[model samples]
Target: MPFAVYVLGLAVFAQGTSEFMLSGLVSGIAEDLQVSIPAAGLLTSAFAVGMVVGAPLMALFSRTWPRRRALLIFLTVFVAAHVVGALTPGYEVLLATRIVGALANAGFWAVALVAAVSMVEPAARARATSVVVGGVTVACVVGVPAGALLGEHLGWRSAFWAVALVSVPALLAIVTSVPDDRPRVTAPTGASVAGTGTPTVRAELRSLTGRRVLLTLLTMALVQGATFGAFSYLEPLATRVTGLGAGWVPALLALFGVGSLVGVTVSGRVADARRSAFVLAGMVSLMVGWIALALGAVSPAAVVALVFVQGMLAFGTGSAMISQVFHLAPGAPTLGGSFAAAAFNIGAAAGPWLGGLTIDAGLGFRSPVWVSAVLMGLALIVAGVIRLVRSPQFTKATVA
Candidate 1:
């Protein structure tokens, strides 16, 4: 990967940490701001809503700017929002700050993706994108946990301050390292088959709405919803079900993050070397099994193992689906990637709500795991159907 991609990864790492750190500090924030836990929870929901609202809006508005400039602008916005988040005094102000931060987060990822892809050769695009997104995986493994620990020891506001501190270096690295050239379209020829069309933004949106692309987005949404629906409440589950102490929950989460890091790294290679659709199908299937095991297994060791596996399968497939979106909608990879990101947040928002309902209704903590398994199964079926539809005729040369 180019050095520029690593800079983008740092930006992504900072963004991801800022975005997810709130989850681990909900109790601390509630106590510090004199708000109810549920209200503190709105911090997460507000961010998700902002991403959903901002993804397409930013993509549409920044269509004409050079991708690098767009990235820098959004990263600046992100850093400013984190500053606001760090300095806010009241719950309402903090909530508003998160909203701004979420918008910047959504816009940054959308633009950074285009910038990353534009920097690499066609054959290297998937790997380059993977390296950029690996920042998110790393955040899951390290940043979130570290922020949570900081918040636990120093106060919740300290976590936001740490995020802000990281943003300065990330911004400097991006501005100094990333090239500022606009994306140029080259005509496709024998040596350059990947450079195809220079479609207008409107035409790009139209093409992206095809059935295959829609199915891919749905698959992404379902898998994300299922995973978050169960995963968000994992700490409570660990305490209530396994009788583990509160201190160990973060360690377990770190394990899950380790699995995610492994998954994202491996999945990138799989997407590059194999058919993305096939890889997506297999990963979703693996996720279903992992969720099932996590729900039904009584042993704590088994639960931890299954959670790690769930993380691995859930994130491993992410690269494949992202690559598929770019391939299916080559005319507007940024918009498509943004839409996928939005779908992910949409699922993130929905999953917790549904899981809360299940818990409120006296369903066991494991019920959400079962629910997630069913949803993942549905996603797997959708993936299989999409693959079959895309290739209805199985030639004797390859099959049977």
Candidate 2:
């Protein structure tokens, strides 16, 4: 993998830190901005909504722009939004900045995925993608906690200040390290041969409309929803069921982050050669992990271990999922990648909202895990169905 992959990863770390820090800042932001906690919570939703909306639009808009130029533009937007967010006087302006930031974030993700894969050999694409995505793991492990700590000591605005300051290096790195020319397009592992320099917007839209592409996108959405729906409530689950101290929460999160690193690294190794099996295995691991959490009243150590295992499973299939998305519509791999980002963000927005409802319904902290498990099981079934129906023999029989 090229050093530019690390640069892209740095960019991902910057935006991802911005994206997740809101979870840790809700209380601080609510207090400082004089908004209801629920209203402050909307900041997270606004970001996710922007990601979903930005993906396809940005993919279409950036079609003619050189990939490096598009990336630099998006990073500039991301960093500038953080500055605006840091200086905002009220919740409304801050919310607006958050949305703008997320739009830039979505664009970066869409372009970055294509750039990463295109920079690598066909067989190494998944591994390259994993390295870029690893930035997200680092953000989760260190960035969110550090932001929370900063907020506690220096106030919520300080956290945004930190994000804005940290983003500078990534922007500079991209300007220096990323190549100016467009990537050479090669056929995806399973994609039918097609002309490419990257598809036109019309071709991109057509590829997105195909049955295989749409189904795979749905699979991506459900799996992501199940993961976040349960994970968003982890703090409460740990406190109520596992009896861990608030101090240990960070440790738990850190352990989960470590497992995420492990999982994605493993995926990097096998995703190219065994993408389908890697994904299936991760799905099964996720189911088992969620089930264990739902079984309830486990020892604190056991709960910690389960969260680590869950994080591993939650992140393990990322490269494989995106790889499949690319293969399903290689004519527009960039747009296909954008769709995956959109689906994941849409799920990130919806999952916790649904999980929150279950908790509010008096089902207790463990309910989200059980609810998420059932939803994940449904996703697993759909994946199987899609696989069966899209198999060569099935397609041939249908044609006959």
Candidate 3:
């Protein structure tokens, strides 16, 4: 509820908008650049790669700076990267700009959660982190759709210009609102200062390596892979399976976004009140079931309903997973959190690629949904095993 949280959220909003708007504008970018759609799609892949490479690198390098100062530096980089992206003359140049932007993004999120936790009391940590991540949820629900409309109506370039324009205010907000508190703990002996050395980050990573965190992250990767695999080809699926025209695709995506927003908001409260792992596991199980039903359903209405449900379960579990990591590694939360973020993006990259292969193999759009279901089922088994391993008796008495 602090003013600083809102400012951090705004920064996150700008970053999320920039990151996700590409999917909606891919065709526009391809046409304008006179390149194939697949080629334009590489822009997205480039960004994901940037995040994977940047998250740990930035965290390691920034390990020594004060949390507030580190965030400001990253936000400045984020804004500058967007400005460059908006003005770039060629596709290669634009791709470079996106990569820089993605790196800035990885650093921004990594520090934001650490900063947020430091700012609030223990009981308020989940809610505060939720507010920061809420920006991404809002981006999916509103920002991406609006940017897509702007790109379609004006031009793809106009969308980046708009992002650049928004970045100005976001930068100013971060500069003025973020506190000047130094991180309470020092970095590890060999680690960088801005990197995760806080008690939370360390504890979470230790827990992550344990049965519970490992299974939780594995479940997350599997569920996200399956969901995004089908979701990446949603337009085709909507067309082929639901018999809908091209015009309805954006609306359906918006509906899914709405589900994600609701799920993310609800998950925080659930994790705060109940067992985080239990909530995560339940959501993952439900998501798998929904995917199967959506794939089999004959009616467009049924498919739409299931899509909404999928969004809810996917992101709801996401919120729980993040909070669980923080709990497990309360000493060094950001490293664990960043690793999880990396896992999510890795899944993001893999899902579309896998889905494309299935489509190319003549398996039809629905086949990806089945693939996702299988992945989710695997995640469920992983989660159940972790639960068994972490049971009270097991915790008190080790099997080894």
Candidate 4:
């Protein structure tokens, strides 16, 4: 409901475009830098690795700072990274810039999530989270595609410049709109602690060690790994396996993004009350969708429709899992978000690597679909165990 939440989402859109637009620009970058295509793709992996390491580290480092100040620092670094990346003459410099940008992006998301949830009432937490995560869905739909188009027409560096330009307005918005952190609380002994109610780093980390919190983080990782694994190879799957022309690749990607938009929006409405059931159903449906896609890869119609379906299910599950992390670890808001961010990025990194391994092993593109299905199946088992453990009957039996 607060305007600052939307501004954070605006910031996410800019950074997320940079995160995904590399998929479209890899070829151009490879050619321009005289690097192999596979070498160019490592840029994406570098960003993912940075996010996995940065979220918690950045959150811990900035935990004592005012939220507004931390956000400004992160976004400013992100914009500057893009500018430097755009002007880089060699692949090594560009790769370093991507890692730097991802670190900033991860920090922004970690803090922004905590800030967004703090601004809203408990009952509206899921809705508030969706508003933040919605930026990624929108970026997938609009920003990445537009970035790709810009790279196609104006060279890849121009796409980088565009992300920097778009982020400037978000930087200005944060300055004007986002509130500074509240004052710290003083204990009876006159020691000051964070206003966030958590007093120490050890306590913050301890809160995340609970069974529910750890499981929720794992579920997030599995769902994301499954989604990205299949998604990373959709192009080859479409052109080679599904027999679609290269021109249809963008359309398929757009369709998947549209489905993600719808999925996250719908999940937000009901996730506050039905987070467990929603995630379970989503993973189940997503597994089935992947299985279907694998079986019917020869049919172009099936591949197209199934990609949309899987996108909806995957993103919907992802958004719900994020809120679930907050709900599970109520004592460590920022750290919980950081843990979720780290989990998702870990999956984002692992998925493509595993998918690539399957391809390099001479498994066809359809093999990635099967890999996604297997990941989702494992995720479903995790979600099911959580659901079972939390059931009223199970608790009563455990007490006995």
Off by over 4 Å in 3: 184-208, 277-281, 392-400
Q: Model 1, which residues run further than 4 Å from truth?
A: 184-198, 392-400
lDDT tens digits, residue span 1-400, model 4: 8999999999999988999999989999999999999999899889888999999999888877889999999999999999999999999999999999999999999999999988999888888888888899889999999999999999999999999999999999999999987424334333235353444566667779877788878888988999999999999999999899999999999899999988888887888887778888888899999999999999998988998888888888898889889888876766888999899888887887788899999988899889999998888888878878788998899889
Error of 2 at 363 (Å): 0.9
List candidate 4 stretches off by more than 4 Å.
Answer: 183-196, 391-400
As a TM-score, model 2 comes out at 0.95
lDDT of 3 by residue, 310-346 (tens): 7777777766666666776544555665766777777
Q: Give Cα distance to truth, residue 2, candidate 4, Å.
A: 1.5
Better of 2 and 4 by TM-score: 2
- Per-candidate TM-scores read 0.91, 0.95, 0.90, 0.94
Question: What is the Cα-based TM-score of model 3?
Answer: 0.90
What is the Cα-based lDDT of residue 353 in candidate 2? 80
314, model 4: CA deviation in Å? 1.0
Sort by TM-score, best first: 2, 4, 1, 3
Tens-digit lDDT string for candidate 1 (1-400): 7898888888889888987888879999899889999999889889989999998888877766777788878888877777787777788888998888898888888887777777887666677677777888788888998998899899888888888888788788877888876544333321113444345666667767877888888888888888788778888888888777898788878887888777777776666667575566655666666566655556688778878888777777766666667878776755876887787788878877888888899988877777787777888788887877678473443356
- For 83-174, candidate 2 gives per-residue lDDT tens digits of 89888889999999999998899999999988888788889888887887888888889998999999989998999989888888888888
